[model samples]
Target: MKQLAIAASILGLLACSPQGEAKLSAAPEGFDDSYLQKMGFTVETVEASAIEGVYQVITDQGLIYVADGGKMLIGGRIYDITGAQPVNLSENAIRQMRQKDVAAIDGEAIVYQAEDEKYVVTVFTDPTCGYCRQLHNDLQSYLDKGISIHYLAWPRTGLQGSSYEQLKTVWCSDDPKAALTAAKSDKRLPAARCDDPVDAHFALGNKFGVRGTPAMVLPSGELIPGLVPADRLLNTIKQSQ
Candidate 1:
């Protein structure tokens, strides 16, 4: 689905006022900023959902649903039951947020664009991940099939550790593609430091529901969270087209 379409779908589910304005209210006293922040929400706006005791919150991080006025949080999919066909409200919102957040990281991504690109995929990758290495080895096949691959670093370990430092060295290198290639080959990069997007990439990946390396975001914004073989990946891209 197009980015706009995905966004529209999310908006469709959110309860709106009669004035056609999004309701923004402060969360209850106990459900203050710090509490929500602990649950990964930097709450910007909060609105009452059609369902009582549930509120839809828009955060700097992403959209989320909370209960107990914000004490409880739901991070996975939510389905709307009133429609002819059930609508995956939460997943659609996540996809829209994922597209927006991923787009911002495109410049930071290590991209391998096909000469005649027919499709584009964003990948969350980890250098130490075995499956990620296998996927990287087949980069040529993907490019040959006219699939542009954009890679965002996702150290399984949180920032401020060895994995973060390794990714930093790769992104900070003069030739990031070469550095990534070497790192994936189990060759260590020289110790280096610079303003890196490692933290941002890792955080964004988490927000996008990336629990593992080699996770793929297709052109339609559908997320596939495992390593897919070259042939199967190519077929998926073609089908999306």
Candidate 2:
């Protein structure tokens, strides 16, 4: 299956500050993330983690934690275990980033607008994937429930293949929606090219951590990584409000 990938390192995010207390950051402390450059990561921003000394380093690729003035790299999420149910502080930070990224590319997506249009969800999809095709096939079901679908291309094989070319044709087509439908049906698309958003969409999906096709970004910026039924997705959107 193909996939797309988020925004805090899901945009370079600010430190997660505790409620009633101001947020602290590592940048002002002159913490050098130049060490990250040695590892080939473009350092976007660095912020203080919920942990006392750990800093969340937001990079062009994704989020990572460092400590001891960038001497240590912690490759896992931070959780507030003090709560009755564990809250993933890292995930929360990334979600906010996703919201910004989604907004930036809002109109570029291939959309299926509902009549009432109660909710909008951005989906990073690949016509090459079975689940993605299924989701496309159920477009009317989703639309009927007032759920509008916006599709972003994510070829999933890292952008160099027939699949990527096929998807590009869809975005570059005179009638993108029809081309997309044809592609999903395994019909060969006539080769076409333009200033298509296909490549940009793929990169955005990768940043959003789309590991597979049919990754849906809910209205609240939370990423749901699979094919979901229309009725259930509607309920989810309502609950998120």
The model with the greatest lDDT is 2
lDDT digits (tens) for residues 1-241 of candidate 1: 2532433244343211112222345655555455554433345567666577777776644566778856566545578989899988767766666677677778988999999898889998888889999989989988888889999988877675766778999999999999999999989798777999887777666556667788998876678888988679989877754
Alpha-carbon runs more than 4 Å astray in model 1: 1-35, 38-40, 44-54, 60-62, 67-76, 82-84, 238-241
TM-score of every candidate? 0.75, 0.82
Q: Runs in model 2 with CA error above 4 Å? A: 1-29
Residue 141 alpha-carbon offset, candidate 1, angstroms: 1.1
Where's the lowest-lDDT run of ten residues in candidate 2?
1-10
Q: Scored by CA lDDT, what does every candidate get? A: 0.73, 0.77
Q: Which 10-residue window in model 1 sums to the lowest lDDT?
A: 13-22
185, model 1: CA deviation in Å?
A: 1.1
lDDT of 2 by residue, 1-241 (tens): 0111121332342222112221233474758776655554456668778998888876555567889888766666889999799999988887777788889988889999999999999999888899999999989999999999999888877577867888889999999999999999999788788988887777677666777888999888788899999999998888865
Query: CA RMSD for every model?
Result: 9.4, 7.8
